[model samples]
Structure formats: C-alpha cells, structure tokens
Target: MSLKREVLYQKWRPKLFSDVMGQDHITVTLKNSLLRNRYAHAYLFTGPRGVGKTSTARILAKALNLEIDEHGEPKIDSKISEEIDKGKFLDLIEIDAASNRRIDDIRSLLDNVQFMPSSGKYKVYIIDEVHMLTNEAFNALLKTLEEPPPQVIMILATTEYQKLPETIVSRCQRFDFRNVSNSEVVKRLKVIAEHEKIQCKEEILWFIAENSSGSLRDACNLLEQLSIAFDEITISKARELFGIIDENISLKIYKMIIENNISELIETLQDLRLRGIDFKSLSNSLIDVLRLGIFTVNGATEIQGYSSDFIKNTSLVFSGSDSRKLITILEKFIEMISIRTEHFDPLLDSAIIHLTYMFENKRIIKEELNQTQEKEIKSPLNIDTQNQNKNIETSENNIKESKINDTQSHEKGLEVNQISKPKLDSNEKQDWEKVLFDLRRAKFGKMVLGALLRNVEIPKKLDEKLVLKFKSKSLHDHFKVEWQLELAREAVKKAVTKVYGNGIKLVLEEPDEEQKNNTKANLLESDIVKSALAMGAKVEEEKEG
Candidate 1:
C-alpha cells in the first residue's frame, strides 16, 4: 500500500484557536462559545475556500469533546485526535452534500440521528457543500434541524449562502467568513514554507499568496506543487510555471500608453501571444497591475506579489488621476474579455489599438494646446484678428468660418477631445443637443459630461463668461485642489469655443449667499412646487433656504 502525501491534521493544521491565521473574530467567538458551553445545535460556516472553515469546525469539535489535563489545559489525546483527524470518529460525521444530495440521503442520515453516540459526548456532523443539497433534501433536514437530538451537533459549510433555503438558514447559527487579507495569506504561507524547509523567497511566497486570492488551502497547495516541481523556489521560475506575465511587460505596456506608442503596444501584444500567453489571463493580469498602480498612487506600498521594480516604475509612470483612468480602461477591457473567448486575439488587438489611439489623441491635443499657448503668449493679437477676420464673411463663409473657428478655439479646452462640435444654424441647437445626448450615452463621456452639466451653465452671447455655481464650497474646494477643475474648465472651453468662436473666456465663479438665497426662494415659488403643494402633498425644498 502506498502512503498518500495529504497533510495530516497534527503536522500542519492549526491545533488551537490562536493558531488559525486570518480569522481572529471567528476564532475568538467560537472559543468563547465552547468555553461557556453555549454551543449551537446547527452552524452555517460560509466563506471562500481554505480560509479555515472545515478546519475551524474540527477544532470546535475537539474543544467540545476533549477533556482538560492536570495542567488545566485541553488535552488532544492521540486516540481521539487521530480518530477525528482520519474522519473515523464515531460521532463525527463529515459528509459531502454535493455527492450525496438526494432526499433519500437526507432521510437515511436523519433516520440515524436518533441513535446515541457510542463514545464521543456529541455527534458532530460536518456537511460540506451543503448548498448542493436538493430542495427536497433541505426540507427533509429542516424538521430534524429545528429540533435535533441532545447529543447531535451539525456544522454545515457552503461556498454559496444564497443557494440555501431560508427555512434551513433560519434554523442555523450563521457565521460569514471573509476572504483572507494579502498580509494574512503571506504570513501563513511563510510559516508553511518554513515548516517544509523550502528555500522560498519572500517574493515567491507573496506571489503565491496573491495568486491564491485569499484561499489558504489554495496557497498551500500551490506552494506544495511549486516545491515538488523545482528543487528550490525562485521568483523567475514561479512566474514561468504559473504563466504569470513578467512585471516588465506590464510596465512596458503602461509606458507605451504614456508615450502614445500604439504600434509598439500592438507589436508587444503580438509578441506575447506568439509566446503562448493566454490573452484572457493577460488581460486580467493587466487589470490587476492597473489596480495595484492605483493603490500605489494612494501611497500603499504593501501590495502582495508586486516586485520592487514594478512598484518603483509604476509610481514613476502613473499619477493618481492617470492611474484612475487606467483602472477605468482596464475594467472595461476586463468586462469585454470575460464574455469574449473566441475573439480574444482580435479583442486584444482592438484594445491595444484603442488605447494607443487614445494616447496619441491626448498627445496631439497636448501639443496643440502647448502651441496655442505659445502663440497666445507670442502673438495674442494675431490670433484674435485672424479669428475675427474668419468670422467676417458671407453667410456660406461664415458657416465655414464658424466651423474652423470653433475647432481652433475649443482645441485648447476639451479634456477628452473625440469630436468637433461645429457651430449651429437655425436647427443646429437641436443637432448639438443630439450630439450631447450621444456623448452622454457613452460611459466615459457620460461621467465627464454629467459633472460638467451639474457644475456649469451656459449664457447667450460670445465673450460673456459662463457661470459655474457649485452646491457646496467643499465641491468647489475639491475641484480647485484636484486637476478635475482644470479638466472641466478645458471641456467647457472647448464646447463654448466649438459653438461660438476663438478668444472666448469661460469663468468659473462661486455665487454669493444672497444670489443663492434668491435662487432657492424663486424655485420654491415656481409653478411645480405650487402645484405639488396645491395637491395637499408635502414637498421639501432641495436647495438651502
């Protein structure tokens, strides 16, 4: 007979409450309950796998049945601990509800619940994957659950709590287990590596922790696999074996975006694909990188699995707002990749092309702005005179001039410059409205436009500064403190310049208290408010009194 390589309970598993990593609240509560003899008849342990759901259940069982030694500490006797460890305990029944989900299985189990335990004090039943039980089986178990035998204790574990029936859930004491933190997972992995005498780098263990995504069992399993595959664990070998994209690739992609190198980005993606890189996984990895970039921008230096070079390079390349924008783009790409398996290569190509084009467009706009500013500083009078001359023509010329003038004027101000909003004729306002409507329909455009709409107002006539009134000084302060104000100001300038002509200055102002009060009072006296009041309905004013 061959001995299995499976981990035994005593060798690696946590023996006491304090030994369990990453579940302090749960362990503490469970220990108090066992110490006070306030154990529940049924328990529902739900969380991501390997965060100590089953392990906690077993520990609870041991605390409940095991006797105290002469030293006044609980004694895990070799015989009882071995029986429980091997799943051979007469009173401890560990059932996989996933495989035995029939009503008959529940009935058979419930039929045996009447018998008293032969040795142990309590009949501990640990039913894993309890969510997989059939509706019929759930109903069959409900009666016994509501009133189980005096010696019976049930610990039901499931990954999906939503799948369980409400009746069954209501009868059990539920504890929600959360995903382990990156630090906690790393800490546990370090202990495991040390125990196995594995010469693992901290970076390698951190990678395993991050890749495991908060599952300790998964992390341990990955570590064990890596240890067996290589004589010693190295960061380079782990990245290769796991098919993880090198941090250099992620940094290069970010640099390409920053430098507006669409061709290089596409070529890079092609090179990676040729190396048998999984586009979907690569996309996901890109999203993670962007996410970590965001955290780094926020001054978080303890992100799991990130190399020192990655941190330093990402910090150098991305500003806070830039990281935010990248996160948004990566999120969109992730959603696109999730549903798109067949067209992965094409999709990757499209994403690279789209991002490259975006970067190029931004670069062009920035260069144009810089040139315009230089021209303004050097020859402000020339720009004004040329724009005025362009406007002073026949009706046809005026139309052409308006188009040219608006394009030139708004070029310096549009934050996200995708379209050229031309001047309107008789029905052009309606067309402009349609264009705005379409822009607002787009996800990114909508967010930017929505902010502008809330904060900015248009007035009739050119050279007349547009008024921007905010609801709160905090909003005004935030806009001023962040680049959002500059971005918003530029967008409005573009829109106005597109509609009017060059040399239009749009001013953002904070309205005085008197003006705000008057505006609020007028709104209260408006027909809408009066009509609602006339219908005997109570209406509270939204604006300050």
Candidate 2:
C-alpha cells in the first residue's frame, strides 16, 4: 500500500517566524529579540487553540538551537529541521502538559533542566496546554522556570492564560497570538489548495473559513477533508457534511416574517426540522442575512457569498425598522436556544410566532399613525406643545372626535378603542377583567400590548398609582424597553378609563415571591377573579382590513 500522507495541519505547519499567519505583533517582536541575541529564558504563549501556538514554539526552538541568517530566519531544509519535524530531535523536547501534569512529571522535568544541550546549541522545552498542570506540578516547575540553566529555554503554551499562576506568568515574556481573520484564513487556504492541486470554488474556501471560527488549521483540515471526500469540492457537499442550512432557506424565512406570513413561516420551519436541519445554524444564518440587510440599508454592498441581487432584494424585504426589531427578537431567541433545552421545537415555534406578531403589529401601528397624521394628534412625548391653551384645545377636540367616532364605529359593527363618555353607576364595581377586555380593542396595536398584559395583576394597588405586577419575568423584561413601556402605559390608560371611568398613573413591576403568593391567595378568594380565571382569555389578533 502507498504511504498515507500527513494531515494538512501538520503538513502545512509554520516553519519560520515569518511563515506564521495573522500574528505579526508576536512574531515581529520575537524576530527582533532573536536578531538582537536578547531572547528570554522562559516564554508564555497564550491564545485560542489551533492558531499556531505550538508551531510557533517549535519554530522558536529551532531558531534557538540552529544558526540563523542575517535576517534572523532559520533555514528549514536542514538536518536539524528534518529531525525536529519528525520528533526525533534530542535538544527540542515537546511535552503535552495535559497528560504529564503530576508533581513527579514536573520534578523529572526540573531534573532535566540542569543538563546542557546534547548536540544542539541550546536545549528547548515546549510545554503545551501548560495550564493543565496540577498545583503541585506548577509549584515544582516555578523555580526552574524562574532561573533555568544558560543552555535551557522553557516555552509554555496555553489556551487559558487565566488558569496559570501569576508568579509563573510574571517570570516569562508573554506573547498573545490573535485569531486568524477569515480573509487571511481564506488567503492561506487558497495557497494550500493551489499547492495541493485541489479543485474547489472560492466560495467553498470562504465557507470553510467562516465555519472554522478563525482557526487556520481547522480551515485547512476541512478543505482537505472535502478534497478527499469529493472529486471536486462544492458548496452543497460542504454544507451537507457540516449540517449547515442553505442561505436560501434562511432568506425565505426572513421574507415570510417581513411579509407577516406566519403560516408559511411555521410550515417552512417544520419542514426544515423534519429534514434534520440544525436550528442553531439556521438561526445564525438568518442573523447574518439580517445583519447584511441592515448594512445594505445603510448603503453597504460587499457582503461575501451574497450577490448584489440578493442584497437588493434583502433591502427591499427588510427595511431599516424591520431589521432592528427582528435582530432584537432573534438575539433573545438565540440566547434562549443557547441555554440547552429539550423542547426546541416548541421554543422555535413560539419565537417565530412572537417575531411575526411583533413585526406585523409594528407595521400596522406605523400605517395607522401615517393615516392619522392629518388629524395631528401629537403625542406629548414626541411633539412640543405651543402653549397650555393650544394643548387644551387639542385635548378637547380629541375627546369630542373620539366620542363621535365611537358612536359611528358602533353603527358600523367596529368597536372604537377609546374611553366611553359615561361612567358606571356609584354601586357598580371596577373590573380588572373588563380592563383587559377593553385593552384588546384599543387603537394603534394595543391588541398586542394587551396580550403582553395577560399575566399582569394588581399586587399592590395604591391611589393614583396602579402597580401592575407581572407573573412572567420575560414579559416583565419586555416592558423594560423604553418604547414598549410607553405603549403599555397608553394601552393601560385607555383600558382603565373604559373600565374604571378614569385613568391612573401606571407602575410596571415584577412580582416578588411574597407578592406572587399573596396575589394567588387573593385570586382564589375572589369570585370574579376565579370566574375570569376559569373562563380564561384569548388575545385579539389584528385582522386584515
């Protein structure tokens, strides 16, 4: 049988300081130090994994043990270099601290530190994942690292620098390797593909780079894996291997949400679930496209893997306002997904429903505001009043017009979402259920606001201040947004006026444990509350006009 080829990561490992990609800050400093013959005895290399930490350490070892040219770059085609590559070099000892992390192992290492180089100029010890060493082992290694023999150089590499002792870290010159950018990773992959004679598309390289998460070795390995699996690498094959959802599917879902087509959106999500699409990937892809849409709205046009036509279409589908709202909602959805849960299907359905409902309601509210612009019902928060007299006239006209519209709407079988002109008799009691019922018919997307208030209760009712407490923390958090709080206050103002014959100041709060228990006990004791609870409530969905 033919000898198996070495893996791409090993085959394409950096050999010289100049060859390390995307970490010029560390490499340049090391090169200058080497050239000046002022390199430290111990070094600490810290960064994310697969970003050339070990390779850089090995290269440093080779430089220290071998003679370098005037440019401070050691030739890699020598006998020592070959031996180092094959792990046969006596002077260059690479240890995986993860496995050999006991005090005995470190003591043995300290015993070896006193010896001179057997053949090379200096003995180099590279301890990788150095943070995995036990407390005793770290303590044993500290004295040696602080003052090693003149001929010995200790280089420590760890992904987690925080786990390392501060005393050990303070003894060495630290070099932090940065992640390889996608563009740099793609450029490096192109060089490799050309060298290996692999047939692949540029987009496929980009796909690999994106999924590798800034690790050049991961990108190279993925590219090699694809080359071996397929005669020619393609996007479809790569996506299938990685379980990545297609961008078209993500775009379609975005379109459905923008168009407020909830039925089709749910059907599409169900189809993807049936076909075993990774929901996390789908969510991430949609977030990317929505981000792209925001960029397009702001006149950016160079997003990768997406055509100008796609950008143009995305801009048309997701307006600036739509992008902002969808992004906020999707961010929350993704956060919920991040916390591992078994009921992902139901969670996804609920998220999609929430997204579409919020989008549709905001759009409807915008349209209604535009249609009523001629009436000039200026919100006190948005527009400045000319004076008290003008404000009073505006308020009186608004009340009179609302009364007339309420009467006319009753005739047309459309209930006006406003306070009635007359109040209840003195003997009649105010009803919380009636407030919620009236809220459902309030104007300017108050129906959506009413749905949010479904679990709200008056845990602490004070005169002039209505403390509406939320049972669901999520619902309570929604009101923390400034605009949502304003909308809630407006809906409550109308609903309370219709039910209690006057509007009170609104105070939104989350129910504490004691308040929650007290509210529950009060609900059980009240006949009206019990009857309302038994009857239950349904949110009034906005109908197409």
Candidate 3:
C-alpha cells in the first residue's frame, strides 16, 4: 500500500536556525549562547501559535547533541536530527503538557531525570504548552527546572506566557517570539512553492498570508490545501475556493459607507452571502481595510497588504477626526459579529445611521460653541436700564434688517393701532397674565416661559413700544434665541388676540441693578415665598463681595 502524503507544514518545517523566518532576534541569541558554551539548563520559549516555539526547541536540542568541530562549531547529524524530529530518539523526550498536565504524570516524567542518556551526551526534555500544567504540576517541576542535572536540558514552550507561574518562569531562561509578518510568511511560502514545484500566483500567496493572520503554520496549511485542490492557484479561483472576500468587494463596501449608501451596502452584502462568501471572512477583510485607511490618513506607513490607491481613496473620504470615529464605529461592528450574527444586517445599518447623525450633531455643536465664544467676548458685565431702553428700538432695527422681510418692522405700524396709553391698565396687565398662563398650551422650550416671566413685571407701555423687563441678563439671554423668541411672540400674540382681540408689539429687556434688586426682594417677600418660609423653609442669602 502507498503511504499518505506528508503535509507541507511538517514536510517543510525549518530544520535549522538559518532557515527560521522573521525571528532573527531570538535565533541569534540562542546561537550566541551555543557558540560561547553558555547555554542555560532550562529554557522557556513563548509566542503565539505556529511561530515555531516548539520547532525552535527541537533546533536547540539538535545544537546540544550534534557533533562539533575543533572551533566549537556544532555540526548537525541529519540522521539523529531526523530521529529527534520524528520523536524516535530515546535520549530526546517530548511531553504534551495539555494532556499529561496532571501532577502524577509530571511526577512520572521527573522520576526519569536521574537516568543517563541512552545515546547522546545529553538528555533533552521538550514540554509543549507548558502553561497547561496544573498548579501542583508546576510546583513539582519548579525545583527541577531551577536545578536540573548537568546532562539534562528542559525546554518549555507555550503560547500564553502570562498564564505560566512566575516562579516557574523565573527559573528558566525565557525567549519571546513575535508573530511572523505577512511579507515573511509570503517569502517562506514562496520557498515552499519552489521546493514542492507548485504553481501559485503572487496574489494567491498574499491571500494565503492575509487569511493566515501571521501564523506560518496556518499559511502553510492553507497553501497545502490549495495546492491539493487545484493544479494552479489564481485570484478568482482562490476567492471561490476559500470564500475569500476580495479587496475590490471591500473597496466597494467602503465606498458605500463613504457615500452613506445603505441600500447598496445591504444589497451587496446579501449578494455576497448568496455567492457563499463568508461573513466572517468579509468582516476580517473590512477590518484590514479600515485599519489601512486610518494609517493612510494619519500619514502612518507601517501597514501593508492593500494597494496605495485603495488606502488613498478610502482615507480621503474622511478627515482625521472623522477617520478616528469611523474606525471606532467599525471596530464596534466587528465586535458585534463575534457576539451575535442574527441581527447583523439591521444592526450594522442602524450603526451606520447613528454614525451619520453623530457627524451632523458634532458639526452643529462646534458651530454653536464658536458662536457662544464670540458672544461672550463681546457681552459686558453690566448695562444701564435707561440706555438699554433707548437702544432697544435701534438694536431691534439692526436685528430686523439682518433677518428677512418679516413682520418685525410692523412693530412701528402697531403705534397707529394703540390708543397712546402712558401706563398699563388693569385690563392690559390681565392680558399679559393670560398670555403667561396660556403658554402651557403652546410651550416650545424646556424652561417654562411662564415661570420665568414671574420674575418680571407685567408689560408696561414705554413710549411707542411695550417693554418686558426680566430681572437678569441671563434670563433675558436664555429667552433670546430665535426659537424662544418666536415661541414667546406667538404665545403672547395668540393669547391677546383670544382675550381682547388685539395685542401690543413687545421687546424683551434686562433690568438694571436697582430695579433687579427691588424685583428680587418683592418676589421673595411675595405671598407664596413668604408662606413657604413661614412653614419652616429657610432661604440662604448670597454674600456678595
């Protein structure tokens, strides 16, 4: 019978330090230690999956047992190295801490520490996934790691260095490996293709590298699958075979986002789903695109795997501040996919809608802030009551001129309708009270204009115009915004028309200190406030400087 084919990952695994990809810092340190004859008794290798921690451990074992030259240079015996690689060498013991993580298994392993090497000068123990060991197992092994026999070398490898006990970690010499870069993964895959005599395109290699997420083993496995499935790998074939969400599709989706085209985005997503494209794969691709776009906008140049045109076109759609917001929003959408997929379409659409509103709200708030800053710079601490009364007509004219041809100039026309009264009569005061009381039926703002008008006297005729004097500039300013102004005008006009069939045209004004103080004192001593105070309510007086 024919033997099954060995996978590329195992068949083409790096057997030498020089063959290791994207880990020069780690490999160089270990080589230097070997050259100087200063190797540690116990070594710890930590990194993410498929970054070759276990493979490096095997290389270190080979360095320990390999024959040497007169210059102390280690020469690997391929036969013995192959035996160790296959876990057949009696002197080289390998442990899968994940399955044999119990303290009893650990104790059984440690009991063999006293025995001598069967063939080589040293016995090597390689423990994979060391963090899987239980607390008792770790405690049992700590002393041995700290004081192993001169002939025994312990090599511990794990993906999660943080989960390993500090006591165990401190006892061993630790080497940290980084995730392999895309370019390095591509380079190694290219070597595999040439060695295996496979026909693969450059874009196909990039697709494999991207989908691998920086794991060399995963990239090799992907390549192996593709090589077995197809005689030659093409871009379209790779997309179809692996359900790869092509960059063009991602770019089109980004264009929809930029244009706020929700309908097109949904349709495209649905079509892609119908074509058997994986939503998770598409999400991953989109995350990469968004990250690249952010990098492009901030003038960051570290990211790759996308074209410059793609980055520039996507990044140009947003400003720097907006790009950050978009990235935050996109990250949230990506997170939602992992939590739940049932409501993905509607949820993503809703998120996009909210993002558009957020952009508009930020613009409005910034404009308001600027207008407020300008107003604060010009407004002063105090105003004379008489001068304010004099300036009211002229300032009203300026405001009117700035507005459209509205009925504001019609305030002068009201003079012909009035009977030239000097003081407000009881009937007119009742009319003002009716206006304030009826505002509840026509309210438009949060602050009740009725309650605020209580701090001011009833409307009094002042020359040609009727004046509404508020106790403070703050109160007057609060009601000075266009919406508040319109609300007050409509309420008063409607109430007067309803009560007496005619209303006096009026303007709001702020009282001077003397009148303001008098009005405040009258309000405090009013029947309601006095009744509350008589019922045991305390009033705190302001201590003015």
Candidate 4:
C-alpha cells in the first residue's frame, strides 16, 4: 500500500535544522546560540501557519537534550533523531496550549518543571498556540518563566503574537517566522514531487505555490490532494482540480469591466455559480486578477509565470488610474462580501445594487466625455471679444465687424479659443514620440502613459481636442473625483506642449449603447470565465457568441 499522506509528512518533515526550507535566519540563530551554551529560558516563536515555528521548537528541544561529543560539538546521532522523530523523548513535553488553556494546566506543568530530568541535561516544554492560554494560566506561568529551573527550557509558539499579553511577550526571547516565498514553496514542492515519483508540470507547482499564499503546509496539503485527484499531473488538470482561473479569462474580465459590460458580467457570474463555485472565492479571485492587471499595466513584468499575452492585453485594457479604480471597486466588493458573510442583512442586496448602478453610471460618464471631446474636435470654437479704449488704435474693419457681427463673431472666437491647435513640425512629432517613449520607460511614467494610451484617443492634428473614453462607468465616475482626471489631462497637455505648443483642448467621454453592449457582452463572458477559473471554478465550454 502507498504511504499515508500524514505518514509521508512525518517521514519527509524537517528532521534537522538543514532540512527546514526558507527559514535559515531563525534556525541558524538558534543553532549558534545553543552551540555557544547561551540558551534563553523561554522563546516566543510567532508567524503565519506552516513556516516551521512548531518544527523549530521541536528541533530546539532535541538540540538542547542530546549529548555532545568530546570536540564540544552536538553529534548528528541517528538514535536521538529517531527518538525525537517518534516523539518518545522523555525529557521533551509537547502541549497544545489551545485545548489546555487553564491555570491548572500551567500549575501542573510548572510543578513538573522543578524535578530533575529523567534523561538529558534540559527538560523542554513545547507549547503550540500559546496565545490561547487564559490570563490566569499566563499569570501562573509568568513567575516560573521569569526564574525557571536552569535545566528547563520553554518554547512557546503562536500564529498571532499580538493576541498574547504584552507582559508575557516582553519576558520571552521572540523569533518571528515569515511566510515562505512562492519560489521557496515551488522548490519544496518539486522535491516532494520527485520523491513521490509524481509527474508534474512546474507551472502546476507554481500555481499551487501562488494559491498557498506563503503557507508551506497549505501548499503541501494542496499538492497531496491534487496528486490523488489526477493520474497525470498536468497544468490544465491542476487548474481544474484546484479551481484556478485561466489568465485569459481574467484578462477578459478586465476588458469587460473596462468596457462596462454589466449584463455579460452577470451572465458570466451566473455560469460560475451553476458550476458550484463559491461567491466569496470568486470575488477574491477577481480581486487578484485585477491586481495582476494593475501590475501588468504598470509594467511589472518580473512577476513569475505571468503570461506575456496577459501582460500585453491587460496593459492595453487598463490605465494606471483605471487600475486604481478597479482596485477600489474590488475592495468595496470584498468589504460587502465580508459584511454579508459575517452578518445576514437585506441591506447587502441594496449595497450590491447601488454599487452596480454606480459602476454603470461611471461607464456612461466616460462615454459622454469621449463624445464631448469628439464633438469639440469636429467643431472647433472661434470667438472674438473687443473693447474700445480711448488710448488704443484699432482697425476700422474690425470695429465694423465687431458691431455688425458681434454675437456670431464672439461665439466663433470662444470656440476657437476652446479648440486645441497643434503646431508640431515633423521634428516636433519625433520629439513628442521621444517624450512618450521616455514616459513609457519610467515605472511611474509607464503606468501613466499606458493608462492614457488605453483610455485616451489622441487626434492627428495637434490643434484637435483630446478625447478620453472609459470602458467602465465605475472608472468614469471615479475619474471625476478630485485631481485624478485633471492630473492625467495635465500630464498629456504638458507632454504635448513640451513638443508641439499648448493649443489643444482635452475632452473625456462615455460611449454609445450599441458599442458598449457589444463590447460589454464579449468582455463580460471572457472576464467572468477567466476570473471564475482563476478562483478555481471548472468551466465548461458552450456555443460561442
């Protein structure tokens, strides 16, 4: 029979300091301190789950108790390793502080600490989730902790250090464990896969690593589950098994949101719902997708395993400002979902509806801005206003026309003043392109320029009005707030004026229904499916539109 997962975990688990991955800092410090005969009476090991806090605690116990060779060195004895491996070390006592969180438990443990060890120089007590201990229990343990028996060592481990009383924390030597990086997790997973004789793709492991969110235990658990689920561990199979949303689908969602395809987005959501996907997970996945889109738009190409097409397409779909807006929306969605999940209320429906409505309104505003810019370009305004001054000389024709066609000429002059006129020579165009190129090169500039290029359409003539269109109503509405739109407009104006002189008016618009509906439908289908898949929903292909 194949080895049980838990048994395998026991067999492959870090047996020594060197076996633990991605926690070298903690391990090395402890080892050095132990070797030098400088040992803390109490240690507080805190971090996120599966980063090796408990494992390190156990290792410390073994390291402290085991005999050293004549060279004043701790021998890497297999017998000691075996005893610790089976948890039969009489001197080492492991306790789940979560369940035994009472004064009696602490008193009992403290009473036993006074006695001489049955074996080895030190008696080690390893308490997991020490933060869960009651105040009375902590108080009882405090006196003993402050002046513990020289032979006794206390190792306290917790995921949430903040929950523990400050007094208790101050008394102990603290060592923080961090979440394992994706690369580290991937590396470990690859090792496990090799040992298991499992055929797996690196991308699949990468996905597992990403989804594990820095928890080695979580990644290992997921890998084990997937290995059991699939006979051949391919990337596609991993995606299906783990409910990973495809990058393409995520990109589609970004486009839909940008394009403001509400109906299609809803339909896509419904499709996901039908596939037994959790709404909360879907929302979270969408947020991650948006985050990735934002990263791509900002030209963060170093993100591991992000597809070239995803980066390129997302860069085209979202501007920096647009990405910020999407982030805001996703945040709100998260908030709403969190509140809904926590407390059942009729107001949640209203909240979702209001949010959706605002999103649509933003799209409409963007369309309107785009249209305004277009109209402004097609009909350049020209106006002239004249005031007669006794000290000034004026032409007779101007004076005559000022009186006879004052209203029409004034209106025409106003129109001309409002309309932007470009005076760029070929040299100027080249200069402007260079400026654009430079802007694209800088990190901040790339984000700004990418957003501008995606959302704002520049006219051929330098004098023509600049039109800014948004794919989503939410973004359009968000753009109206404070200096966001103004800043973007100013940036473009500055760039143009630097090269071609300042003769252009900038206009922002929202598109018409027909175009929006069509775009929205296509975008919604793509994005929803992508987002769903990313969140780990299984997608079944249907007839294409």
List the candidate numbers ranked by TM-score, top first: 2, 1, 4, 3
Reference-based lDDT, residue 179, model 3: 89
RMSD per prediction, one decimal? 14.2, 12.3, 16.1, 14.1
User: Tens digits of per-residue lDDT for model 2 on 1-545?
Assistant: 87967998899998888888999998888888889999999999999989999999998888887888877887777899888888899999889999999999988888888788888999999999999999999999878889888999999999999999999999999999889998899889989999999998888888898889889988888998899899977888898887887777777887787668888888888888899887777777877776777777677867875667878777777764534455676568558768677776677667766777656644555565575674565643445556845754543333311111121322222111211122222122225644654555443421254545666643232334344556543335443432234444455556666654553444454446554344333433346533443344332321212
Q: What lDDT does model 2 reach?
A: 0.71
lDDT of 3 by residue, 64-128 (tens): 89964443435666677778778798988999999999999999999999999988879999999
Total clashing pairs for each candidate: 1, 0, 0, 45
- Candidate 3 residues lying further than 4 Å off, grouped into runs, are 68-73, 272-277, 299-303, 312-321, 330-346, 358-545
lDDT of 4: 0.64
Error of 4 at 42 (Å): 0.6
List the candidate numbers ranked by lDDT, top first.
Answer: 2, 3, 1, 4
Off by over 4 Å in 1: 1-4, 7-11, 68-74, 296-305, 319-324, 365-545
Model 3 C-alpha lDDT versus the unseen true structure: 0.70
**Winning model by lDDT:** 2
Local accuracy by lDDT, each model = 0.67, 0.71, 0.70, 0.64
The estimated TM-scores of all candidates read 0.69, 0.69, 0.65, 0.66
Tens digit of lDDT per residue, candidate 1, span 220-245? 87888788899977878888888877
